[model samples]
Target: MKGLKKKRKWIILGAAAAAVVLISIIGASMNGAEVESAVVDKGQVIKLIKESGTVEAENTVVIAAKNSGEIRKVLVEEGDRVTAGSKLMESEVTSAQMDIKSLQSDLAGLQAQYNQAKNLADKNKTLYEQGALSYEDYNASNTAAKQLSAQISSLSYTIKSYEESSGAAGVTAPINGTVTEVFIKAGETVTAGASLFEISDLSNIYVKVDLIAEDADLVQVGDPVKVYNEDAGFTDENCKVRKIHVKAQEKMSDLGINQKRVTIEIALSQSTALRLGSNLDIEISVDQRENAVRVSDKAVFELENKDYVYVVSDGKAVLREVELGLEGEDFIEVLSGLEEGDVIILSPEDEIQEGTKVKV
Candidate 1:
C-alpha cells in the first residue's frame, strides 16, 4: 500500500510540471503581438503672422509758438477736447501791443507829412508854370513829395507786420482734436517755434507697423488687418492698409545683414477703444489654408531639432519624422509623414517603448 501511494504522488508531480510549461508558452505568444494605441486625425490649418506697433491719429499736429513770449494764460489742459480755432494759450503781449501802437502812430505821422508835401508841390508847380516860382524850387518840392510817399508806404508795411505778430500771441488749434500734451504752463516763457502742445484727431487713428524687407512684399495696400492692445483695452478691430513705405531702412546693429523695412499704415475703421500713441500687437494674415491636416502641439516631438510624430501601425507604435508648415496656437500643420486614417499616440510618456503592449 505504501508503494501505490508513492507512484500516485509521482504522477501528480509530472502533470503539474507539464501544465506550467504550457502556460509559459501561451504568455510568450501574447507578448509578441504589437501594441494598440490612439491617434489624431489630420485636417486643415491656418497660419498667422504677428507684429507689434503703436496707435496714432492719422491727422496729428504739434502746436508751437510762432513768436517767443511769456505764457500769461493756458486756455486748455491735457486731455481737454477742443475744436478748430480753439484758443490753446495766451502769451504776454503787452510789449507787442505797445509796439503796434507805436507803429500805427508813426504811420499816421508819415501820412500827414506826405499829404502836406503833396499840396506844397502842387502849389509850387502851378506858380512855376505861371512864372511866379523859380524852376529849382518846384523841382525840389516835387522830389520831396515823392520821397514822403515812399516813406508812407514803408510805414504801412511795418504796421501790417506788427498786427500779424500780435495775433500770433494767442495760440489756436489748427484742427478739432484732443490735447495730448501741454508743455508750457501759464507763467512759463517759451521760445519761438518751440512745441507747446500736441493735438491728435482721434476720429481717424491708424497703426504703424514695421516689416522686414524680405516679408514686406507679401503685404500690399488695401489689405485687411487686425489690431489689439492689452493696456488700452483694444481688440481685433477691422482695419485696412492705408499706406506702405517702399524705402528700406538699414538694420541698426548688423552690418552684413543689409535689410530694408516697410512702414505699413493701417487705418482703424472702429477706434472706440483705441487711444493715441497706444502700443498694440497686430496679426496679419499673409495667407490662409482651409481643411488642412493638423495635430495637437503636445503630440508633436522634436528630435535632433527635427519634428516627429508617433504613429500606430498594425497595433505597433512607430516613430515617424515629419515636415511641418504653418504653426497655430494649439496645433501645428503637418506637411508630410501622416495620413487621414493614421492613429497616433497622445502625450507619450518616456517609459513607453516600441512594440510595447498598450491597452489604448
Candidate 2:
C-alpha cells in the first residue's frame, strides 16, 4: 500500500510538470504570430441591391426626315435648346422641287394648246351655224378644246400637290425641347422616314436599371433609391421607384450565366447634373436593421456549409460559429456568436485552427 501511494504521488507530479511545459509552449506561440483584427460594432445594416443604370429622358421624341433629299444644312446641334416650329435642318433642292417645276412647265404647254383649240372651236362653231361646216367637224373641234382644258386643269392640280410636298424640305421641331441626338449632317442624302434627331425635355429625367427577377420582386413603386455618379457630381437620394416592368427579359451575364431581368425606372425629382445616357450606380434598400451588431464580411467565412468567424480571446484564436442575418455590400449582421466590442480576426487563413495562439 505504501508503494502504491508513492507511485500515485509521482504520477500527479509528472502530470503537473507536463502541464507547465505545455503552457510555456502555448505562451511562446501566442507571442510569435501577428494578425489583423477588428472589433464588432453596432450600426445600421442595410440589405441593398446594387446595380448600374443609365440616365434616360422620361419623354424622348425621335425626329425623322420629312422628305427624301440631300440635307442642305443642319441648324441645331446636340445639346441645343429649341422651341416649337424651330427649323432643325433644311434640305437642298429636292426631287419634289424638281417635280413641281416640271408640272408647272407641262401646265404652261397645255394652256397654250388649249388656247389654239378654243380658237379653232369658235371658228368651227360659226361655220357650223352658217351651214358651211359638217356637224361632226364642229363637234370634234369643241371636244379637242374641252380635252385640252381638262388636261391643263389636271396638270395645275398636280403642280399644287408637288408644291405642298416641297415644303417638307425644311424640317422643323414639333415640340419645345433640347436636342439630345443629331443623326443627320449637311450634304448627306437621307431617305424620308430616316432618323434625323432625338429631342427631349431634359429638365426631368429618370434612371433605368435592369434587376434580376428576384431583386425586382423585392422593390416596390415609391421606394426611395440612391443614385451615385462621382464624375457627374450626382449623388441623389430623392429618386423614387416609378415603374417595374411586368415581363422579364432573358439576358446573358458577364460570366455566361443566363438571367431573367426586369426593367425598373427611378424618377429623379431634380436632375440637372446628370447627362442623358450617362451610366450611374444605384442602390435600393430591400431590408435594413438599425443598431445591429455587424462585422466586416472579410472576417466571416464558410466551412462545411456553415458560417464561422475567428474571435480573438485571451491572445488566442477562438473559432466560433456565427448565425448570419442580413448581408450588405460592406458588412454583415451577426445574429449570434458575436457581441459589441468583441475583437475578431479579419481574413483568417485556412490553417488557423481553434485554440491557436494569436497576437492582434
Candidate 3:
C-alpha cells in the first residue's frame, strides 16, 4: 500500500508540472503587444523654460494730444528723427484761448459782484449791531456775500485750468527718437488725449517675452538666454535677461487657457533691422543638476499628487512610485525610487497597468 501511494503521488506531481508549462506557453503567446521604452541613465539634466516673444524697441514714447483742437501743422512724419523738446505738431488753440478769455471776463464780473455784496454785508452787520437793521436783513446780506464769493472762485478755477492746459499748443518730442507712427494730418480734428505719434529709439531694441508665471518665479535678471528667429533665420547666441516687470498680467493662450504672465526683457548682442513686433523663440536654461538619476519624461505620470513611472521587467510593466527633482524638457531627475539600468516604458498606453505583460 505504501509503494502504490508513493507511485500515485509522483504521477500527480508530473501532471502539475505539465500544466504549469502549458500555462506559461499560453501567457507568452497572448502577450505580444508592442510598447516603447527607454533606459534610466545618469547625466546632467538642464531645466529650461521655453518662450516666444517679439523684438520691441527698448524705449517707446506715445505722444498724444493734450487737448481737443484742429491740427494746424504736422511737423514730423513717420521715420523723421526728432530730439527732446522738438515740436512734433501744432494744434489750433484760438478757440481754447477765446474760451479762456470769456471765463476770465465772467470771473471779473463775479469778483465785482462779490465786492459789492461783501460791502453791503459789512454795512448790514454794523447797522444790526447799532439796532439800525433787523436780524433777517443782516442774515440775507451775509448769505448773498457767500454765494457771490463761491461763484467768483468757480470762475477763477475755470480760467486757471484753461491757462495751465496745453490747449492748441504744439506737441513736442518727449525724447530723442525717430518718429515711427503718425496718426493725424494737418486740418484733422483731434480730441484730447488722441494718439498722434509714436517715437522709439531702435538702437535700444531688445527681445521682449511674456513668461508664464510658473517659470517667471524661476527667472531672474541676468539669466542667460538663447534667442533665435526661425522664420528670419537669425540667432543671437549671447543674450541675457535685462529686466523683469513688477506686475503679472493675465493673457489667454491659443488653447483658450487663461495664464498669468510676467514680461521679461532680453538684451541681445545680435544686430537685426527687424521692426518691432518681430517674433522670436528663446530658450532659457533656468537650472541644471549633474549626475542625477534621470529618465525620459514620457515615462512619468502623476496621480493624486504622487508621481509614477511604468517600469519594465521580464516582459512585464510594473508601476513604480518616484520622487522627482528638477524636470527638464526631455528628461526628469529622479530623486528616489528608481536607479540606473532600470527600463521604463515611454508614452505609456492607457491599457498598461501593474503586472501587465509588455513586449518592449
Candidate 4:
C-alpha cells in the first residue's frame, strides 16, 4: 500500500510539473505582440507614372471629297491597304461636266468678241493720233475692248472651276496606309469637303496620353516609357516621350471628376504591335535608383509631416524617424535611419508604440 501511494504521489507530481511548464510557455508567448515584419534591403526602385493611353497613327490622313458629287461606286472598304493616289471610288459628276462645257462655250464666244474689239481699239488709237478719230470714239473703243477682255477672263475662270469639279468624279487615296474608316458608299450624295475615308500608316504608330497636371510636371521629352496592353498580351518597353504640349486643358475624368490635363505623345518602334485607336497602358519612368535602401511602403507612416517606421530591435518595436527619397509603387527609398538588414514591423497598428513588445 505504501509503494502504491508513493507511485500515486509520483504520478501527481509529474502532472503538476507538466502543467507548470505549459503555463510558463503560454505566458512567455503572450508577453510580446504578434506582428508581421520585413527586412530592409537594397535594390533598384523605379518611380513610374502609370496611365492609360490610346494608340494613334503618327501619319494619319483623312480623305475628303474635293467637290459635290454623287457616289457611283466605292472600290475600297475599311481595312483595305492602299497606296498614294490609288483610285478608291468613282462618282457621277454629270452636272459639273455640263457646267464645264457651257462655260467653255461662253469663254470661246467672249474671246472672239474681245479679239475684234481689241483690233478696233488699236486701229482707233492710231487714227486718233493721226487726227482722223475723235477722243470720244477712241475712248469708247478702248472701253468696249476692256469689257470684252474682262468677260473672257471671268468665263475662263468659271470653266476652270467646273473642270475641277468634274475631275472629282474619281476619288483616290491621298496617302499610303490602311483604310481605317469609310464614311460614304455607293449612291450617296456628298458635299464638297465631306470626309470620305480615314487612312492610317500602321507601321508608324504612337501612343497618346493625357496626363494630369501633377503627373505631367514630372514628365519630359525623352523620358523612357513602356507601352503595354494586358488584355492583348502585347508589351513594348522601347518607347520614349516624343512630345509634350505647352498648355494644360480642363478635362472630365472617367469618374466625372474635373482635372487639368496635359497631352503627351510617346513614339513607338516600327515593329510595335499596337492597333490604332486601341486603349493601352503606359508606364513612364520618371525617377529611379539603381541601388537604393528600400522598404515596403506599408512599414512607413507619417506623423506631423515627418516619415516614420516601426523598426524591430531587441524584441521591441522601435519608432524610428526616416528621411525618405524617391517614392515607388510598392516600396519607398529610405534615405537615412534605416540599415540594409534592419527588421521592421509591417503595417504597425495604432496601439503599437515605442518599447512595445513585438514578436516577428
- Candidate 3 local distance difference test against the native: 0.87
Residues 281-338, model 4: lDDT tens digits = 9999999997899999999999999999999999999999999999998899999999
lDDT of 1 by residue, 215-290 (tens): 6787778776788777767676577778889787765423566566777887777747466677788877665556
Off by over 4 Å in 4: 1-31, 66-69, 101-169
Estimated TM-score for each candidate = 0.63, 0.68, 0.64, 0.74
Best by TM-score: 4
**Clash number for every model?**
6, 0, 0, 0
Clashes of 3: 0
Writing each residue's lDDT as its tens digit, candidate 2 over 119-163 gives 999999999999999999999999999999998888777776655
Q: List the residue pairs that clash in candidate 3.
A: none
Arranged by TM-score with the best first, the candidates are: 4, 2, 3, 1
Q: Is candidate 1 or candidate 2 better by TM-score?
A: 2
C-alpha positional error of residue 217 in candidate 4 after TM-score superposition, expressed in Å: 1.3
Each model's lDDT comes to: 0.77, 0.87, 0.87, 0.89
**Candidate achieving the largest lDDT:** 4
lDDT of 1: 0.77
